[model samples]
Target chain A: MDSIIEVSGITKVYQKRKTKEKIQAVDNISFQVKRGEIIGLLGPNGAGKTTTIKMICGLLKPDSGQILINGVDNEKHRLRALTHISAVLEGSRNLYWRLTVRENLEYFAGNRGVSRKNVASRVEDLLQKFRLKDKETELVNRLSRGMQQKLAIAVAMLADTEVILLDEPTLGLDIETGYEVREILKAIAKEENRTVIISSHDMDVIQDICERTIIINQGKVVTDDRIEDLLKLFEVRSYTITLGEHLNEKQEHLIKERFLDYQYESNRIQPKLSVELLKTEDIYQLFDILKLNETPVEAIDREIIQFEQVFMKIVKGETTNGVDQVKSQSV
Target chain B: MEWIKSNLNLFKANFRKETIELRRYLPNTIAMLLTVYIIFMAMFAGIHSVGAPGTVDATIQNTIVNYIFWYLTITIVNGQGYEILTEATRGTFEQLGMSPSGIWRILSARLLAQGILTAAMMIVLLYLSMLTTGQSLNVDFVTIIPIFLLTCISMFGLSFIIAGLTVIVKQIQAFLQIFQFVLAALTFVSLSRAPFLVFFPITKGVDMIRAVMVEGLTLNELGFSNFLVLTTNALVYFIIGLATYLYCERYAMKKGLLAHY
Candidate 1:
């Protein structure tokens, strides 16, 4: 894959007005975006996702390091580099509130030097694709949040840039609109063959659309991996065991001692134990504890974990050394 | 050539947008029209009060000329420059800055649009004054046209200065109000005492216009020295405004205030 954007050792620090304390918004970070890749930038609030995206889009300059768009240094040849990228920042900042949707599209297209004759057809195609044809004549401010967001993306698309930077595209949309946006993004990534870097708190949107994910915490990247790999790695270790009989006090004590994070639910007729194992062999040790009480296990099933749970584990620093421990115990 | 093509498109689009915005604020337009009418009516009343019975034509011509100068200056300052300030306050300045077009071209186009509107207003007001006061229609088109053009160029320069101030101050409307107050006082000083204000550019322009319209002085009769001073002042103000805009652009970038609303 060809790298379309190369961001290396980028850092941004903002000075607090009252305290005059410097806050690091983006720490020394380096990442490369391949052509036609959909990458998700995930982080909690104040984790510098926005600052990082702004730096990449040339909206905000980094304190140190270089951002190369198509091998052109953004700071050195800003207009030239920016010509190949467009951004739909948070809260739909790219739009004109009073201009009608059609007018905004035409204006942006014209700004990009698209011929007057081509603007109409290009706008029509985008309006139809974004499902905003009916609202073409409506003022942007009058449109619903979902429509505004769609129009913003549509406008970015009209710029015909190779890379599209979307900051919280689904930040304030309803579930249906969010899903629609996700579908549109998927289509855009697949059909248009454009690089997309999305900074968002919506894990579902990230899970549904992005192939790779970069998780940031405290302005530093904690994990950058394929989404499926992270999900499978975290999912394989969780299990729920159905016990044939209730656990006695001694057996419960031993189980608690061995499996620190296990849960016992006594409400079910058979009773159930939910635990995550560092290794598949750890289940045998669990069996050893049940055997001490002569308690038989009826069945054991793997627990499917969502991306949100895997994210929580990674963010809490619980998964850093667990992968090694799991491998040793399983072998 | 490329710049012209791009600016032509930008100017057309911006002019259309401004027209839409102006139409939406119909009440303001109506208010402006009423204000212009009232000023003319008040001038007529004042002329009648001064025991000038048969000198209505001369008085009306004098009042119309003054009104043209005053109204055009006020409109350019408050109308076009105020809109630029509003755009700055709304964070649209960053949007414009990020565009490939230069700031000078964008602003110049806006001023050109304002000049056209001001010229149209002056013509309408001239006609209206003629109908109301029955002024002699013996107007010297050759003299009035050049005076009007020079006045507009000077006003454009002043508007640019005001726009630069608006960007630096951030609070556009308040800055404009204060600017207008100072301008009103300065105009009073210049008009009340001619010799004391002859050193000022605006006053000099007004004097030249009054000389030709009221005293019927030709370009040769007035000599080239006064024209040279007026032209120099306009050029100086325009250069100052451009320099101020460039300085403000740098300040905004360093302070990270371009995108701040």
Candidate 2:
């Protein structure tokens, strides 16, 4: 697929107010978002996710490199780039509390240089689609948080831009509203066929709406691949082996050398060895270690991994020597 | 033609939004207008209590012109700056910055809308003040409109400067509070007494407005050099103010200030 947004080697640095110490918020990060593809940008706190989002939105200028929206360089042509993109940076806070729902739509559409008369039909369609038709004339602050959030997203959609960047679209939302937001996002992607880059800590939203996930850690892109591939990779690489007897010293040493990251449960009734292999065939090496002391393997279970766990493990730097070494998506 | 259409739409959008907000926040709107009236009344009361009874009528009329321009100046400049502060606090300012028409254009449109609304209120206040003082100077809007509009251009320029600072610092309330008095000084101080004030934003326009409203001067009577000064102040200050605003915007973006308070 052709890329709709190209962020190339972008870096952002900040200075501490008193000491003037330089902190690199984003360190040489780069990613390409395909047209009509929904991608998740996941990271921990202070992990440069907001910095990258602001850069993409043209609200913040990166110290180095370039961001191109529809082949237009954002830094050099920020306004023109904005013509092709819009964002809901703070969800409900993005709206005018004093303005009504319909007024907010018209106002934001106007901001994008589209007249209210021109977008009147589109606004009605969005209000109906987002289930906000009944509350069109209600003040934004009077609306429920879910409705406010939906209006914010509706405002973004009204811009009619190709790419929409939503930072924490579901933040501070209740479960049902969060679910509703997720559904709206899914519908937006499917119906509009627009490229969407979402930054969220909610793993479920990412897993449900995004085909690809980019995990950032310590100001670098650690893992960028398919969400399903990551789930399957993490699932297949993990194995739990139950031994009939405790492992001898040689077997323990061999297991530790072969699998740097594993759980040894000798204290339990059955000595179980939980290890993740770099490759599926590495299970043979584990078998060799088990045979050294005639350690009888009673059962071998492959541990199933959830996307949240996959995200956690990737972000915690746990995948560095294991999966990261083999795949090496990090820069 | 497309540029004209989009910008017109942009202006209409903000203009309607501002008008709707004014209507929705009717109590606050009334309070703002009343506050100016109350202040003018107090000034009128002062003129009555201690005065040369012979010059009382002229003094009241002059005070009315000064107070009217002060109202326009304060609301035109500080209103937009207050908006910047509020939007920054509420996190909506960045949304304005995200517009394709650009923040500067939106702000310019918003400032114009605000100026028009304030002008309407100022007219009502002028009539009320005249009724209260029972000393009408001149109600000639034909002469006053051109001067008021030109002065508003300079005021818009000053507003852009305030907007630039507010977006970057978000804590310029103290400066704005003190600046209102400075605007008062500009509106109250005459041209012949301080000729150099002509170069400053809004000062020339206000002096010209004072001439038109208080002295009943026509456009031709204002002459070539004075009109030149007025036109130059409007254009020069507007260009300078917009440039300063854009520069501060670039600085804010570099410092990542747009997203935070």
Candidate 3:
């Protein structure tokens, strides 16, 4: 697929206002988002996801490197480059509070370069498509958060830009509303060929919608892979072992030292052991620890890993193999 | 032609938006207009109570010009900065920046819309003050147009400086308030009395307008050389203000201050 957005070695550093200490917000990050692809940007708070998204949308300039949209360098030709892009930045509801839904749509459509004659029809189309037709005459501030978010996205779409960047689209939304928004994004992705980059903390959003996911932690890209591949890789190592007896001190110490995120439940009558190994062959190491005390292993079953668990592992820096798997897949 | 066409579209969109906002906040607009009216009446009453009857007409005439000039200066100066601050506060600054019209075009359109509305309001107030004070004066657009145009351009230039500085120095209202007092003082400086003060961007134009309004002086009567001096001050200040704004904007983007309120 041809790349629609290329972010090359972008780095952003900020100095603390009081102490004047330099903080690396994004460190030499590079990625290419292909045309019509829905890429999820996953990261914990303060992980530089917002910084990266801002740079891509031309809201912030990187100290080093470039962002190109369809071969136009954003830094060199900002307005021209941004012509191909639209973004709903985190915390930027991006609607005039005083403007009604229809007015907001019309204003943004005109402001984003739609001709005066086309603005009304385009806004009407979006209003109907986004299911905001009922609330078209309502002020944006008066709408529910879900409706506001849908309007923000609808306003972004009014530009008809090739790439749309949504930062935390589902943040601060209720379960039903979040699901509705997720459905809206899903529909947008399926219905349009535009490239969509969503930066979200919700694992379900990444799992259900994105074709590819870029996980960032501490100003670095920790894992970049398809959500399926990550889930597959992490699921194989997760094992729940029914131990014949409670783990002895040496066995517990050995397991703790080997597995960083293992849970050993001493349930007295029926002790349980759960561990996620780095490798499939590493089961021998677990057997060795159990064999030391002649501890019987009643049954060992592979635990099903969710996208959230896989994400936690990657962000917690518990799995280098996950990054390696993703790196190899990208190649 | 394409550049003109695109900018015109932007201006139209922004003008419409502001108009909608003005209508939406109609009560606020009326309140602001009422406040201006009350202040004008208070100043008139105060002047009438304290001043000599013989000089009352002259004082009233001079006061109208001075108050208009001061009001225009502060509104343009404070208003330009306030627009930027409000955008930042609302978290809409980035969206405005990201628009294909660009920040400069957007700000230009917004300011132009505001300028039109303000000019109309000022004209209304000018007539109201004259009628209420029981004074009749010559209302010549020919004399007022040139001076108004010159002052607007000069003040716009100064406003650009204020707006640019606002991007870096978020707490700029205090600075603007101080500048308002300085402008209040500058509005009284007569070009005929102190010709060297023509070096000031707005004083020359204010003095020229006061001359035209009070003394009924024509462009030729004011002398073409004096007109040149007035235009020169406006042009010079506008160029400096534009340069300062462009520099500050570039600096703000580099420092990531564009996202800061």
Among these predictions, the greatest lDDT belongs to 2
Cα lDDT of model 2 by residue, B1-261, tens digit: 999999888889888998998898899999988888898899999999998989998778889988888888888899888999999888899999899888999998888888888888888898898898887776677777877777888888888898889888888899999999999888888878998887788778777777777778887888888877787888888888899899999999999987567
lDDT of 3 by residue, B15-111 (tens): 8888899899999988998898898789889999999989989888889888877887777777989888887878788888779787766777777
| DockQ values of all predictions | 0.26, 0.84, 0.55
Q: After superposition, which runs of candidate 3 have C-alpha atoms over 4 Å from their true positions?
A: A241-300, A320-331
Local accuracy of candidate 1 as per-residue lDDT tens digits, B1-261? 876677777676666555665676779877888788888888787887884678766666766766666777777766656766666554445455545454555676667776676678677877887788777443566866665566566667677677666655655676666666555543333344657655454666766776776677887887888778777766776677677766665555434555554
What candidate 1 keeps of the native contacts, as a fraction, is 0.07
lDDT against the true structure, per candidate, is 0.74, 0.87, 0.83
Q: What is the lDDT of residue B45 in candidate 3?
A: 91
lDDT assessment of candidate 3: 0.83
- Writing each residue's lDDT as its tens digit, candidate 2 over A1-331 gives 8898888999999987799999999999998888899999999999999899999989999999999999999999999999889999999999999999999999988877788789989998999999999999999999999999999999999988899999999999999999999999999988999999999999999999999989888788888888888886666577899989999988888888878678899998888899977778898998888888888889989877789988887876665324444233521
* Residue A22 in model 2: lDDT: 96
Q: What interface RMSD does every candidate have?
A: 2.9, 0.8, 1.4
What is the lDDT, from 0 to 100, of the residue B66 in candidate 3?
83
The candidate maximizing TM-score is: 2
**Top DockQ model:** 2
What is the full ranking by DockQ, best candidate first? 2, 3, 1
lDDT of 1: 0.74
